[model samples]
Target: MKKIQFNLTFFLVVTAAACSNRYQTNNHTAANKADTVQSKYINQPLVSHIYTADPSAHVFNNRIYIYPSHDTATGAPGNEQGDHFDMMDYHVFSMDGVGSKVTDHGVALSLKDIPWAGRQLWAPDAAYANGKYYLYFPAKNKQDIFQIGVAVSDKPEGPFKAAAEPIKNSFSMDPAVFADDDGSHYMYFGGISGGQLQRWDNNVYHADATNKYGEELAVLPRMARLGKDMLSFAEPVKEIKIVDKNGNLFKAKDNDKRFFEAAWVHKYKGRYYFSYSTGDTHNICYAIGDNPYGPFTYQGIILHPVEGWTNHHSIVQFKNKWYLFYHDVQLSGHTHLRNIKVTELTYNADGTIVPIKAMK
Candidate 1:
């Protein structure tokens, strides 16, 4: 009887050990599957041949399309003149498969169409709304006056045509358009000092300039509501201040304070995220705010001065994943050879963006 009992006890122990091993293996398999799912959702740009700068992208019909400031076949960058000074041009690139890789489709638009524009053209932003695609760009007049212009196309890849004359009397460049869920449209643009808020009117707004140059005299970081059509502002302009040079709360004439330019605002998970570059364009900085027109608080610098001198960025959500789109001087060098790069954006629990590391 004792020998029989020993044999049974040993068999039971062996069976329990085998079951434990099976459970451990299953757990590891599940963990690996989760990691794979997370990685697949994180979108990064695939390699491409074109060297472009100040890229603005919009995803539609399950494909991502990018438009950037023009670069000549000789690999020369455009917009040498002041903002709104150039005959605006842009190159079109598309991802092959959904999230596959970027390919240059060649020139989407050029200045020859707009005979009136001067020689300098700078940043460009594109968006799809109301069954049409719009490209917003800056161009100069014969008198060297800077203004924002719009081009519209039936499809994403476009021989876009100027919808109307340059929105006259607006100075700060880099025009970005955001259509809110409530059907209101807003256009944001500015540089160094701060950006402006204007209602989008197919025609232009005629307002007296508070400054000498006829530029809006208001401080940097401003916003205005747009009319239903997304062309003009709805209300008077309001200013947004994020941080000072000392990284404190913003105040007038704070030598250290920085305002918004290359500004983009998005609503995520019921919160508004406004991200803008600070310091100098060459040294891109960032900040965040709960409100669109913010009394925003400075989070920190996103991209510091590195191989390239300047950085201007945009953020987008594709396939439920967030990405940072910006230009870096990696291969192009000090010639400001800006090329578009896409990277994963991680977030903190406190609702701030994780700082980006400088490229090696």
Candidate 2:
């Protein structure tokens, strides 16, 4: 009787394992199917079918394309550890020509295709330069520490191919790339708590050092000049430090602009606007400077927190109108999964953006 019981329990365990594998396979298959059916919607909260957030928008070849991260619960086997962001893929959305249909170019990149990535993807940015479209993303490695990677494609909406490895001197995440009018390329990146920053030195591909508070770098967001290849840094000393409203900058808990993450920089009417999600993670604030690298004075909030604890945005002027793309948690019923929202961002007479509430 004891032997019979042991064999029956063994059979049950094997069956459960097989069933679990089948479930995962089915879910992935369904996701693939959904990726192909690009739903059409014209409203706030751009995507509702699947949770999507962290929008990075740009005007490419007279059309607007958005690269956003996929939002999900910690994936597969289940998050027995509770809820956390679990983005394994990315999708690109575009409005081909001004009044044409909004196209969802599905699965621009996915972790299943990248061998080095530890199966986690985060906020990403894209740019068109030198006849190629580039996608910069921050993802974790097998060790669970996050680093940035770049992928390339001939088309704005891509079936992209990633480089063999990540960008050498990249650390943290939320990579925002900007191409200047003079054909120069720059990238803004980083995010951490208590104003501590981890960075890569020219001497070390991995960050062997930590930047402390009160330094020019700690309080400000960092931007590096990209090499012609767009994968390496060109100048070490020219890294940017974010400035504040009073010609000052953020510090480690010493100042009000304790910039948490989401570094977004855009130029408006010859003035560079440096915007970011402040620490409390609920506000998307801005500051204006004279150059791409800023000595900016704080302007004001472009987006205020609504229901979620984190906020991120991208600003773009499309078809002669400016729009702010950000995310919130109203649809998910919990903060772990989020949805993207869009609204018209208005500028004051003095060039500062009027504070706006996040919708949908």
Candidate 3:
């Protein structure tokens, strides 16, 4: 009886193993089919009609909301002249489901609405915190000096009011906001020579200006901690750099500066990923890193300029699936009137992101 029982248990175990293998194989097959369908859909030209660019998107309540720089006239090509900046506006779009094509909702915020907003209101990033939706955008004053401003509304589609005066002492727009699991908030902005992070303290900052550039300069991509009230920083600023440009690691060029702008940082599965646009903004490239303050190694190109000069991008994940949200100027003819586009992002075994083809 004991021998018979042992043989029976062994047979049951073998059957279970076989069944598990079959289940995994079937699961993989189904996933591959879904991917093929998605690839076909993404390959289609998404924003062939309108000229919109500098996209910032967030997933809220199972829907994705995108805010992009909008062209004033429908079917009108963007004006690239310095004076053309005044024609730009901020428009919001939403989809009922994640990864769905965004439908235009007219204008959410416009340059004419803000009392002090200059002719050009550039890249805008939005976040939902507490009970309010906050938008951080770059606009010029009557003097035409560019500055960052904040607006608040109760809903994503909002008649948002300017919450505070334009943030002083910062340049190189494209502002992004990140709230960590610990309830701390950080704002990342600036461009090639303008990136920096600040701690929030009730919609205000103490303004730390101790870097080599001095206090008045707004350095791009600098990381700092936020205080309890969510308006100011709690620590000294740490400058983040890419690995290819790092003197300690690669020794590429002391001043050969590879562009790193439009930074979006997220911590996932014990690794912090910092994605930024590299090279020229018109010929934008992409790289990733494990640390927020890098040594960020070049992964590969996410989207290359198809009909235009460069690509500005943002990455967000919803429901365990990752999507790359970005803007391109195919229709606007290399002007700043960039249209928003979306594509699914896949990862390699070593955690590198797969390069996506530019939509035709």
Candidate 4:
């Protein structure tokens, strides 16, 4: 075995340098050079060396914050495999604007510190509501059942604390929450095993999906509502799927319509855009509907697949331009050790999204 030593002095120097306004001004100046890909084009693998994947980008207090699932190398603490995804913690990075130097805020939370979770922390998302910030994450309990939990903090860069227990009676992962303009909050969660449909029932959670496990053959993307507090559900609902422009649902076995995981929702110009990683785990595709919880019609792929076996992302508008946040395996040459990337997104006047070409 080997022990790795850290250079505290060097780390402090680098941290201070990164925080200095002069360094940032220089970086921004370099970014503006026409020869710079960051200024002219989207420079990728937002973080280098370490594998950080499954990006959840958000806007809080006018800055762009990215919450990414931290990927540990084989045999590192909490990693159970040498050749697959074995994440156990999360890190947050923020920037004043796109193409700016990202400030690493360090570890926001770790599975080992969560009293009620196992060490397989997967994907996570965050939301702001009720004067505090909340982190929604999924991990297996001691019994190995995957469950969703919420952590809270006063700041987006957080010392987030997981609740004593996961959302009661919930059984899924990849929790994505949206706070609507009407003073209401909703949560969209589920993955792989046909997404669970849930809602806020009288400020508490209730079964939103009618089909129990084994009653179905494939995974269907599901949606539900969150209470004002953003933690409870009302009742179970229906699975989200591909539909024609006429609003008819796709047949059960339509591979193109089948949901694999990573459900995300956003609204632009009164259209509810539902995006998810398809069953192929390659492309990030989306559908649009008239309402937040929708009978959305399949549009097209937002991102073509990278080398990774899984894909997860979030869409956000910063400074009036749209950007897609996702990851790829190009850095490590292995699917489990992926790196986060971003690219500018464009759209047609009819609200149809122009497909994105992901950078390595």
Choose the strongest candidate by lDDT: 2
Backbone clashes (count) for model 4: 13
Q: Report RMSD for candidate 2.
A: 10.8
| Ranking of candidates on lDDT, top first | 2, 4, 3, 1
Q: Model 2: which residue pairs collide?
A: 219-250, 220-242, 245-298
lDDT of 4: 0.74
User: Model 1 segments beyond 4 Å from truth?
Assistant: 1-48, 72-88, 96-99, 193-219, 243-257, 279-283
Model 1 quality (TM-score): 0.70
Which ranking of candidates, highest TM-score first?
4, 2, 1, 3
lDDT of 2 by residue, 70-150 (tens): 888764443422126678899998875434566778889999777678856888999887789999998887766677899
Local distance difference test, each candidate: 0.60, 0.75, 0.61, 0.74
Q: What is the overall TM-score of model 4 with all chains considered together?
A: 0.78
Model 1 Cα shift for residue 129 (angstroms): 2.1
Each candidate: how many clashes? 20, 3, 23, 13
Tell me the TM-score of each prediction against the true structure.
0.70, 0.78, 0.70, 0.78
Better of 1 and 3 by TM-score: 1
Model 2, residue 283: C-alpha shift (Å) = 0.7
Locate the minimum summed-lDDT window of 10 residues in model 3.
Answer: 248-257
Query: Comparing 1 and 2 by TM-score, which wins?
Result: 2
Higher-lDDT candidate of 2 and 3: 2
TM-score (C-alpha) between model 3 and the true structure: 0.70
